[model samples]
Target: MTDNIWTYLMVGITFAIYLGIAIWSRAGSTKDFYVAGGGVSPLANGMATAADWMSAASFLSMAGLISFSGFIGSQYLMGWTGGYVLLALLLAPYLRKFGKFTVPDFIGERYYSQTARVIAVFCALFISFTYVVGQMKGVGVAFARFLEVKFEVGVGIGIVIVLFYTVLGGMKGITYTQVAQYCVLIFAYLVPAIFLSLFATGNPIPQLGLGGQVTDGAWLLDKLDTIHTDLGFKAYTSADVNTVDMFFVTAALMLGTAGLPHVIVRFFTVPRVKDARLSAGYALVFIAILYTTAPAISVFAKTNLISALQDKEYADVPQWFTNWEHTGLLGFEDKNNDGKIQYYNDKNPDMDAVAASNGWKGNELTIDQDIIVLANPEISQLPAWVIALVVAGGLAAALSTAAGLLLVISTSISHDLLKKWLKPNISEKKELLAARLAITVAVIVGGIAGINPPGFVAEVVAFAFGLAAASFFPAIVLGIFSTRVNKEGALAGMLVGIVFTATYILCFSVFKMGGPEDYWFGISPKGIGTLGMIFNLVVTLVVTYLTPAPPVKVQEMVESIRYPKGAGAAQEH
Candidate 1:
């Protein structure tokens, strides 16, 4: 497909808009850089938060996971969207009312100790760094594919783009740019889904298209279930999900969403506490648009792939097939020399025998299922501009997330560490310069990591979520609502939670020693972090009771934060 001029024009227009916003809303002070002067509208803040939350994982990976996993993939759908609900009900309002520049600030002042703040800062940094690696990798992948450049060069370009606005505009610049990104990504995601749905099932809405009958008047999911079972794969609608693991993954995702420093910090950008609460609902609504469409897209893409490939012989495949194969995304081997692509359960004995009899060795079609969603338009013969838009949308999703995380990381180093710890009397000008330097260094490191990510992007993100769930969620929740919670307890809780969660993940995930055979009490490291959260809650409550209550002055400050109406309020500027 030729590069469509319309797609290039659209992408160019989007870039110009982003650069314009960065120029218009450039930050001049610490407050502006950190929290966007706390003057963003509720709706606008909601859009920005949606953009921040919907990273490369959401845009590039979620539907792919769903396509491969079927109903079991609902875990991601439930876990990710349900998190916004938990944030809306449990965290957003109170945190916004607390009105701080950073999440660590709340911890520092709430516990009346620098120790609590430092610990929170560390957790924030850990979660942000791990998550950003995935986004950076995503940026590299999108750019490499769309621009036909080396992965490292794509990563460097992505880093430079994020650094330009992130250093200048901070949260203020990010907020507006993210709003633009949200538009680009959502349109890019939905357009093809709608086209595919209409083409396949005569329905524009994917949720309906998935369940509605296909052209043959059979329910799409039911047909998919039949095909899946025939190939020894799990049913489309009746996947086997471990209840316990499902519960933990869902809960952990919720806690992590509420605990994420970059996301929670967006609430502070709103002008009022009520606005924060309302905006969370709006964010969820915006996110749900894509979430609801994802399942349909998953089913559609999977069905289309099987139908397209089931009858095509290896020697007769088209140019598009070889093109994708060159990218290492599609592969096949005629193990038994039948010269046909056999796609089935590789481990299923019955299916293996059948494949062997037919001169096939296991499931030889080696296409990565994750490519389905992004490649849907091309597979279905959509216009080139639509393809280009997909490229732009993916880049937007990745860049927006990277920008947000870079801001959080830079703030932690510049404001929390340098000005607060080492040099208390640093001038404002020096502080701003330090913040930019920190951002530059961070972008460089992130770019390098993107070029050579240490682990699977999905697995790393999961671990990051687990870490946040275990460490920051408990401390933040207790800090605001529990007036009796003291410094000793909060600090201890953070340390214990962080240590336990890190150890659990490290043992199983990094060391690879905690599979089912070696799992501790049937709790794998991936799920054990949820257990750590319970431990944190218990330890914090018990320690708080055993220790003395927070000082009266601290209690008064908490009360003031809860209710607003004073000139001494923490102003953004």
Candidate 2:
């Protein structure tokens, strides 16, 4: 049978498992819908959080970026995964002890202001919506490529799957479902990585193989650097971006990871504040399994790709090459028409001399880095089963994250927006219904976005992080550490952070309103959140100093949440 058979079988099996979990663990009360009844075990929640955090960007895009960008890409591996350490130590426990259904709820109560709650809800929606669009688009791309369906149909299918589980069982279902997704995604990610690593180097372990000598007894990094230079590209292990830019970008991503609403809500599902800390540790271990492997996979995929295509006769190119080309993700032009292909950085001035000496016309290949993960298996001539598994894995990643983000959107709408303002006297059953209704609407919006996505997952997701870091991270941290941060200070800080970050991103990245010099201090819009966070901190402190301190009762609530000594069992209202 063709690969599509395995693709259908594996994807169908995974979806069935998810739906089964949803049906088995259906949510009844608001607490169950929002926080999985606050009873999940640490290990189970850990796996769920890993799945929720990884998303399509981590599973599909990171390796591709690292494959092309090389050494500088390590920042993502460190910034995104290492962030869990910061979360475990800094944020998770306090929020867990506060024992809220959502991050905005905690923010609202902690600040003791409805306006602060509203600000948090808005920030949460913006960040979660930005993230869900990527996942929904990933679902469309994965299904289109693997299932041989129209892109629209694939996206519709994905949205329906998510709506069925999330609308039906809410966080309670998503929690267990994500555990299964974690298993499927991790297995699919590791299998090809191990095979490719063993093929490229003598070592079977990918982390060690990344540093190990190649078949020619050359250090892997050394060999890649040689290839990079020969192709008129920067050395594979060199920093392509400026140092200051990378530092700010990495810091923004780290803070964003700690602040993202959906990921933060995972700890709320666990039974106790201590379990939240332990779950962060366990979640980091699960995430590290992939984060550590991705760079190795990047090197392996890039090296294998160059080796396979460079200087090879066009007529003799493999079917996988032609397959991807048909999708327009990979392209070629027979410029020289000498029946052979040449792939290099033709824009490099030094390449003009090389092209002249080799009688080459121009660079013929145009491959999008986003295609690397999906195409890696095909390029390796791996078994059809493996390719199908990767398709399923990509779906798992996209679906798991979409489910989480949809929950965030829904919870905020029902709990923070409607429940707080319109219908304070609503019953538990009606609240559950409202949450489901909100999910249906969110899924429709997300599907529409998937049809016309904003940009690449990695790039757009960075913007989401920037928004989260700028809007929420500072206020939340200050609220915990300093009881004096009153409502006006928190509100002013959020408005300043969000407006500054959004305007910066809109000017530079979205509108292309300015060039590199137009960026503030040469910091890319993606990294501007670090500056925004600092601004929020400063403005919040200044405003707090200018205003009266928080009332005594509010100060006591902050004090109660600071320590874990009497955290007791997780309590839900």
* Number of the top TM-score candidate: 2
- Pairs that collide in candidate 2 are none
Least lDDT summed over 10 consecutive residues: which range in candidate 2? 564-573
Candidate 1 has its poorest 10 consecutive residues by lDDT at: 564-573
Off by over 4 Å in 2: 150-153, 335-340, 358-361, 568-573
Q: Write the per-residue lDDT of candidate 2 for residues 1-573, one digit (tens) a residue.
A: 687788889888988999999999999888888889888999999999999998988988889989988888877877787666877789888988887777788888888888899989999998898888888877877876775656677788888888999999889999999999999999999999888888889788999999999888899999989999999999999865788988888998989887899998898887777789888889989998999899998999998899999999999999888766655557888888888878989879989988888888779888867678888998988889999899899989989999999999998988888787568888778888888998898888888886766566777778888888899998889888888889889999998998999889878876788888877787988789989989988898899999999999999889888954656544444
The C-alpha TM-scores of every prediction are: 0.94, 0.96
Error of 2 at 32 (Å): 1.1
- The local lDDT score (0 to 100) that residue 407 gets in candidate 1 is 90
Pairs that collide, model 1: none
Each candidate's lDDT (Cα)?
0.80, 0.86
